[model samples]
Target: MPRILLIDDDAQLGEPLAAYFARFGLELHQATRPSEGLARLREGGFDAVILDVMLPEQDGFAVCRAIRAEGDVPVLMLTARGEVMDRVVGLELGADDYLPKPFEPRELVARITTVLRRRRAVPADARLRFDGLVIDPVTRSVERQGEAVELTGTEFELLLVLAREPGRVFGRDDILNQLRGHEAELYTRAVDIVVSRLRRKLEPLAAIKTLRNAGYALALRPQAHG
Candidate 1:
């Protein structure tokens, strides 16, 4: 069963949605406050989070950003405003998807199912040989020259994005959008931070290449073989 954390102030809406998801074999954990939600996120070991944008105190955007800073859990944002800017901003803030208020329960279930499916579909191949480094995405592990190296969650996601498509020149915005999910807030240096962190971990192998202002790409060293 997939575990879901729902952060919304509207008890009426939350209750019904929780009940609806429960019928589908999902375990829903509800939190009406931002602080409580964050706490649950850290401690509850959930698969995904459904956050309402109009929460008291910090709001959903802040909560989402904070969570992104910690891990890459899929986040689905719910906003009553339904404005394009709001949707864009939510994507820029690292939310996986966004749904406007007054949405159908079925639609919510569908979105949740889609996100979970994508997350689970990430391949478990023992090793991804990119450039000179080998990455095991399933285990969150990496190896260079037959030696293991440590990487943080953000670094691993960044590397996974680039290595998944070698020679592809992904723009910073595109990389950020991909790794952070569709609903991340735009930041001038967010991609740079992730890249910089990745570089530090990959420096030993020097497989990842920066494409000047275009973005970053992964290229295998001529002599390095799988």
Candidate 2:
């Protein structure tokens, strides 16, 4: 069973969602406070996180950014505000997906299923080596010039897709579909944000490249470490 962490303040929502998720072999853990949520997350057994946008004290945006900075645990933002700008902000903060509030429980289940599925689908013995950079999909770890590089779940996934087919250009749409497993309402900038974050962490050995009027690609090899 996949374990999920739900960081929302409402027991009304959590009670039903928990019961619904149970039917699908999912274990739901609830945290009503941001601090508590972060604590539970630090314990490290969750497959994905469902965060509410209107949490008390710190809003979901701050919470999401903090979570992304720590690691790439998948996040699905739940919000009563369904504006495009709100969705864009959530995506930019490294959320894997966003679902508007008052949504069907079934839709929430589907989104959770997609994010978790994407997390597990990796090639066997899945390792990629490029010049001074090394990526092991099985371990979900990266190293640059023999030093370990910490990557969030989303950032790692993005890099894996690019590294899998080095030199092959992947448009934003292709990457979105590859990560989310569906045609989503994601702005192209979402891909850009993940790429930018990955680039910062994979620096010096910089293997990712951009194409004008095209898309992004991983260089066949990174620059030799000095």
Candidate 3:
């Protein structure tokens, strides 16, 4: 059974959600305090986490960043705010997905399942090679043209997103949502920052072009037609 840690101060919602998840075969562990939740995470062996944005001591974004610094466990953040900034901030902090408040229990289940599916789909081979660049998803390492290139987790994920859909122009919001593991943020240039960082690393091999207010595109040079 997949084990999940749910951290939410809202007992009214958390209680019922815990019961609902149990019926789906997930082993649910609930923590109403941020400290307790972080402790449980450190104890290890959790398949995923459902973290609420609002908390008593520490906010969910802080917790998300803390966990991300330690590991890549899939995180699905819960927020009653539903504002674009809230969603964006959560994603920037590395939450895998976000669901607004008043959501149906069934929808939560679906999101959890989706995150798990993506995790399972990630290549076991730690390294991915495309053209001249090599990416190690596990260590979050990247190499281009036989040279090691440093990339932040978000930058690496952004590259992976674009490479996975070659020739596709990913708008800022789409790219944000993809790497964010959830919704887009409002009035934040996180995606732009990620792109700028990625471009610097990719410049030695390929060109990462901006589409004039549209978003970004990684244009692969045409192979010589022999």
Candidate 4:
């Protein structure tokens, strides 16, 4: 059974949602406060997190940042406001996906399932080696300049998509499609945010090059195979 942590302050949402999730072979755990949620996350064993924007103590963005700072546990943010800015902020903070409030529980399940699927999918092949960057899809690890680089799940996926095709300019829409499938509602800014985050993490490497009004491409030269 997949374990999920839902961080929301709604007194009435947890029980029903937990019961609903149980039907799909998912174990749902609830934490009403951000602090409590973070504590539970630290205890580990969570496959994914469902975070709410409106919460007591710290907001969901902060919690998401904290989670990314610690590890690459996939995160799905919930925003009752459903504002575009909210989604953008959440994605920029390293959330893997987001869903608006008043959403169908089944749709929520689908969104969660999609992110979890991406997180667990590992390509069977050799490692990708660039000028100063090395990516191992099998292990989901990245190394830059001989040092291991920690990246969020989404960040790692974004890098892999580009590194796989060096010099290929992928427009924002192209990246969005690759990362989140054909989710038309997902804005292009989400791709920019994730790319920005990935760029910052792989700093001084100068791997990703932005094409003017075009898109982004991996500029790193591939290391020759022996």
Q: Provide the TM-score for each candidate, comma-separated.
A: 0.65, 0.87, 0.71, 0.94
Task: Please report how far candidate 1 places residue 65 from its true position, in Å.
Answer: 1.8
* Better-scoring candidate (lDDT), 1 or 3: 1
Error of 3 at 105 (Å): 1.2
lDDT of 2 by residue, 101-211 (tens): 778888889889988887887768547888878888878889888999887667888888898788899999899888877656656877888888788878886678889
Instruction: Please give the distance, in angstroms, between residue 60's alpha carbon in candidate 4 and its true position after superposition.
Output: 1.3
Can you tell me which runs of candidate 4 are displaced by over 4 Å? none
Off by over 4 Å in 1: 122-124, 132-134, 140-165, 168-226
Query: After TM-score superposition, what is the CA distance of residue 197 in candidate 2 from its true location, in Å?
Result: 1.4
lDDT head-to-head 1 vs 2, winner: 2
Which tens-of-lDDT digit does each residue in 1-226 have in candidate 3?
8888999987777667778998988778889998999899999989999998889998999988888777778888898754768877786666667788868888888788767765655555545566677666665567787888755445666787876556778897787667544633332376775576568768777657678878887676433221
Predicted structure with the largest TM-score when compared to the true one: 4
Would you list the C-alpha lDDT of every candidate in the order shown? 0.76, 0.84, 0.74, 0.88
Pick the lDDT winner: 4
CA shift at 122, candidate 4, in angstroms?
1.6
Counting clashing residue pairs in each candidate, in order, gives 14, 2, 1, 0
* Colliding pairs, model 4: none
Clashing pairs in 3: 96-181
Each candidate's root-mean-square deviation in Å? 5.6, 3.1, 5.0, 1.5
Clashes of 4: 0
**Candidate 3: TM-score?**
0.71
Instruction: Answer with 2 or 4, whichever has the higher TM-score.
Output: 4
